[model samples]
Target: MRKKHEAPLDTLNSYLPVGAYHTVMQYLGHYKVHLTITKERRSVLGDYRFAVHGKNHRISVNGNLNAFAFLITLLHELAHLIAFEKYGNRIASHGKEWKLVYGEILQQFLLLDLFPPDIANEIKTTMRSPAAGSCAEDGLIRVLRKYDRKGDVKKLVEEIDVNGLFRTDDGRIFKRGDQLRKRIRCLEIKTGKIYLFSPVYEVTPVSHP
Candidate 1:
């Protein structure tokens, strides 16, 4: 969970999409936020922490994400900061107030034509009813995955046929099962235990004789 402090725009450009440098930096500057580029975390893409007694607002985004994903994740966290600033702790997280703020912020960015057509369309649809997580929109997540850096081939759990095997990042093998609502049932090879996994969980497919 190492966090790298803000770097020069030249250095930061490596992690952001083209034409997004100034806008992203401006938000960080205006809010006096302590922006951190962090190592990947399984549970969340990015997060925000409001300012306390003597500290500035803090925001962190996973550094390993693609440039587009990086920018989107940053904006998502920025929206959280803005919502908190306006409403304190009165509103529920991802409630109406937060959704409105998030949609507004995302719409502003959309006007800049920062994203590709497919991604933009999916994002627009997502804004109508923003979800708690940035990748909550299945269509958006599927489109975003196309921009991911190529290497270490992997596929979403939903892409694998039932009974097919896949290996997670931790090297555990699982046998894919039926789809149950949004999650897919999977059986662990070693433990023979069943687990429910998000359809979007990326895993390497396994070939068995």
Candidate 2:
């Protein structure tokens, strides 16, 4: 009998890269995971919640991600689940144990050659010591962005030239300023307020006269 939490293989296929359905399904079925593909979230790419009190392990990934990003995010969350099962909340969430588990699981997919050359290389480098968040790996995120839908017009904040004008999705305009460490400073046009933005923040470019 099919577990109530298990998604049908065909339905799950749409959310994953080609050739990934069977392997991913095996994990989900074995663990009885409840996976949800959610709309884009500003704060997280995916999240994991371990089973408790009759509830099954739950994982959620952003629906807006490209196939490669989606797969990586799913694995990220799955690692959290696996680590929790192994260590039973006795270790840090993103500590050595979690990183080791994440790396090993990620390596399995890497062997499949499911990603483009550049993306695969970046993933290999990142797997050595996986970060708490997939987006924290700038090189990996940059490479993954190439696979985003072609119709998407948004550009990363880092892609904007210094002093270039850009508009956030919320309709606010800003002038891209210098980078202060990892974050970029952008001056808001409306209130003249400056804000630090993630390098990967997506905004539309505003052409100047």
Candidate 3:
């Protein structure tokens, strides 16, 4: 349900910081690329399409139509275009080239942070650990319970230990015995009963390197 000229560059320009508009114009001068924002289900947060005729950029806001997400999503998609234009997909997404460009634009041109303070802080924390899962422990539990049936839940009991906490890829932590109704799982504080309707991914303790 995305239109070709949905979010025109002029509208997007209004959201940019004072000097960012000029920088973006300079960066994307060659491709004749068009930026569009829509209420579509974007495969990724943003996407770049370069057909033989022209180029297009699409960002899926998913009703998070705030200026912050809009700006970041726009920058993220622009990073894709910049990467493809310069490197031609030779490197990984978010690889050295993309990261460099992202950092440069975010710091110098954008004159602001890449993400909001909380999200940026979370990213910093996530970079420290590599063994975390996609969602928070509670979120994972919720997904599991949604797919699991009644009576299939198992009870788990364990002692509270510093090592029992699970850290997510985004750096959010959940203790081993925390009661989560979404996942229908709870660890009996004394008995260490880990009750769950289904088996979710295991959370391994991170060993200090």
- Which one is best on lDDT? 1
What TM-score does candidate 3 reach? Answer: 0.47
Candidates 1 and 2 compared by lDDT, better number? 1
lDDT of 2 by residue, 78-153 (tens): 9888888888877899999899999998899988777788988998899887878855688888888999999888
lDDT of 3 by residue, 1-209 (tens): 54434555566566553445665666555545555555554233356565444434433332223444444455656666676668876677667676666555545533334344454444344333311222223332333233333553232222224335543333434445443553435343444655452234434333231
Cα deviation of 148 in candidate 2 (Å)?
Answer: 0.9
The order by descending lDDT is: 1, 2, 3
A best-first ranking of the candidates according to their TM-score comes to 1, 2, 3
Worst 10 residues of 2 by lDDT: 1-10
Candidate 1 to truth, TM:
0.91
Quote each prediction's TM-score.
0.91, 0.89, 0.47
Residue-wise C-alpha lDDT for candidate 1, range 1-209, written one tens digit per residue: 55556545568888988888888878888889888777757678888887999899988888888988888888888988999889886678889988898899889889889899998999899899988896678888889999998884889999999999999877899999999998899999999999999998888999961
Which has the higher TM-score value, candidate number 1 or candidate number 2? 1
Scored by lDDT, model 3 comes in at 0.46
- After superposition of all CA atoms, the RMSD between model 2 and the true structure is 4.2
Global Cα lDDT for candidate 1: 0.86
lDDT winner, 1 or 3: 1
- For all candidates in order, the CA lDDT equals 0.86, 0.85, 0.46
Which sections of candidate 3 miss by over 4 Å? Answer: 1-5, 14-20, 51-63, 110-209
